[model samples]
Target: MNIGIIGAGAIAHFLLEKINRHRHENLRISSVFVRNKEKYRLLESAYGVSLYTDLEKFLDSDIDLVVETANIDAVKTLLPSVLKKKDAVLISVGALADEALLTEISDLAHAYKHNVHLPSGAIGGLDLLQNAHALGTVTSVSLTTRKPARSLIEEDIDEAKTVFEGTAMEAIRQFPKNMNVSIVLSLAGIGIEKTSVRLVADPHIDKNMHHVEVIGDFGEATFSITNNPLPENPKTSYLAAMSILGTLERIGQKIRIGG
Candidate 1:
């Protein structure tokens, strides 16, 4: 599997490290795509792979899969081209909250016969949520995400603050990077408009915490996860990068484990 990576941020660096540790002889990194080559000149020199700032040149590379570790806006801009040719793994799943964009991606991927993979990022029980929704109608879904106040903003907050409380769409709009898990649950269960979200900036907690609650005809399900922040980037969870790597490994394996 010849992989092409997008972005040169913390998640991208973490993913490259994980891939190197896997030592998968068949899986090779073909190239890297970034907006400004000058900014990541050191990364380009260190990796020894072809670095491209041009979209057309990157798309023309011999890449079987594209791993996107960039922001939601970058995903919105670059994903369509990748979806038209090769399969892609998107870490910034929040971009799919836009129904029109999601529809466009779906249509393009369908036209090209390519798959877009969304990993269970940072949180868990997504497989169960998807299966439950498939079997029966899910009445309600809510996500409560608690993270360090510093992660949300640079200014210090002494007490736990309700940073955002609204529909998934609003939360995504308010906190694009911090509340991606809410959008993930929304995609799996209801949608951005229907799925409720509560974002809290807690001064007491050092780690990022997510608590999801779902109610349906099937039953009631609740999941809570406390994730340590990535050392490279305090705004992101370490588990977020691991989840993508896990999905990549599963793609190469023969036996299926989850739904």
Candidate 2:
């Protein structure tokens, strides 16, 4: 697996550390795309890999898969090229709220015959939702992201209050950067317009906690995960990086443990 990562931030560093620790076979990090080369040059030097401060130069590399570990805007920027190749996994799925852009990407993928990979962000049950959605109706899906006070800007948040409560479409419209889990859940079960979201900022909590509840014909499910923020990138979860590494491991070999 010759992988090209979009961001060399905490998620990139953390995932690579875990990858090196596990010692997987036939794995290579061919290239990385970072906005700031000087800030992230150490990673390239340490791994002995190519670094692309320029987006075009990075996309031209002979990497097999492009894993988007960057923020939402970066994901939107690199999506077209990744879809051109048909082997890309997008982590910042909240960026797909622009139905125009989403439709464009979908049309392009269908024209070229590709797959857009949407990972279950830090939370699980996406596989179940995907299957259940294919059958009957998934009536309700809700995601609540509870993060520390620091995660939100003063304008976007209230002190330990429910900052957002509406349909998932509205949540994605309002909180483009913060609430990616809503978009992920929306795409999996119901449409974004139907799914719902509740965002809270709790000063008492130190970590980013995600509580998800689903109600459908299949059954009802509830999942909660508290993600410790990465030391390097406080905006991202440590588990977010780990989840990307997990996906990369699964992509390489047939040692299928968990589906």
Candidate 3:
């Protein structure tokens, strides 16, 4: 598979290194698309991949898949065009919080015969939630996220604080970067309006923590995960980047394991 990347950030760097280390015969990173060619020229030389500021040229390259590790703004502006040309692996799951945007992307994907893959990201238990949802048995899903104060706010804090509590829709609107996990959980179990979320900033903890709870006819289930931050970026979880690799591997498999 020829892969194109849409960002020149930390996740993009991580993907390039890991893919080179693994040397997957089936996967080759062909190109990258970014706004500032001059700023990101080093990435091109480092990875030996073509970098294009022109979206047209980038899309015209020998790429079968495009991995978008960019933000929600990039997803809104670039994804429809990408899906028209190639299948995409989207890491900015929070963009789907916009109902109109989700509908538009879904329609585009259906019309173009392209698939938009969403990774499980920082949290798990999605398979169980999806299964229960398929049976119409999942009644409630809630996520509580605890992160270091630096990740959530600019100022130093002496103690833990509940920053926000609301439905997934509201949470995503408030903390777009930090609450993408809630959006993923909402999509798997219930609609965003029904899925609850709580955000906490803790000065004492080092890891990004997530607590997920589900209730339904299948019974109650809870998941707790403590994720180390990526060394290059404290705002992102290491597992979130790893999950993209897992998604890429799964894409090549004939026998799929889970939802």
Top TM-score prediction, candidate number:
3
TM-score for all predictions? 0.93, 0.88, 0.96
**lDDT (tens digit, per residue) of candidate 1 on 1-259:** 8788999888888876666444556666668899888888776556556788987788788888999988898889999988887899999999988889999999999999999989989999999889889965899999999988877867788999998899999988888777789888888888889999999989998898899999998899998999987888876788998898888878888999977
lDDT per prediction?
0.86, 0.78, 0.90
Error of 1 at 196 (Å): 1.1
**Candidate 2 segments exceeding 4 Å error:** 20-23, 54-56, 153-159, 255-259
Estimate, for each residue in 1-259, the C-alpha lDDT of model 2 and write its tens digit. 7878888767777766655434447667778888888887888667767889876677678788888888788767778877877478888888888788789888878977887777777677787777777775788888888877666646444458877899888997887877888888888888788887888878778898888888888888888898877788777777776667767767766677544
Please name the candidate that would achieve the greatest lDDT relative to the true structure: 3
Worst 10 residues of 3 by lDDT: 19-28
Better of 1 and 2 by lDDT: 1
lDDT of 3 by residue, 83-187 (tens): 888899999999999999999999999999999999989998899899988888888898999998877888888989999999999999999888889988888
Please give the clash total of every predicted structure, in order.
Answer: 0, 0, 0
Candidate 3 shows a clash count of: 0
lDDT, residue 91, model 1: 93
Q: If candidate 2 were superposed on the true structure by all CA atoms, what would the RMSD be?
A: 2.7
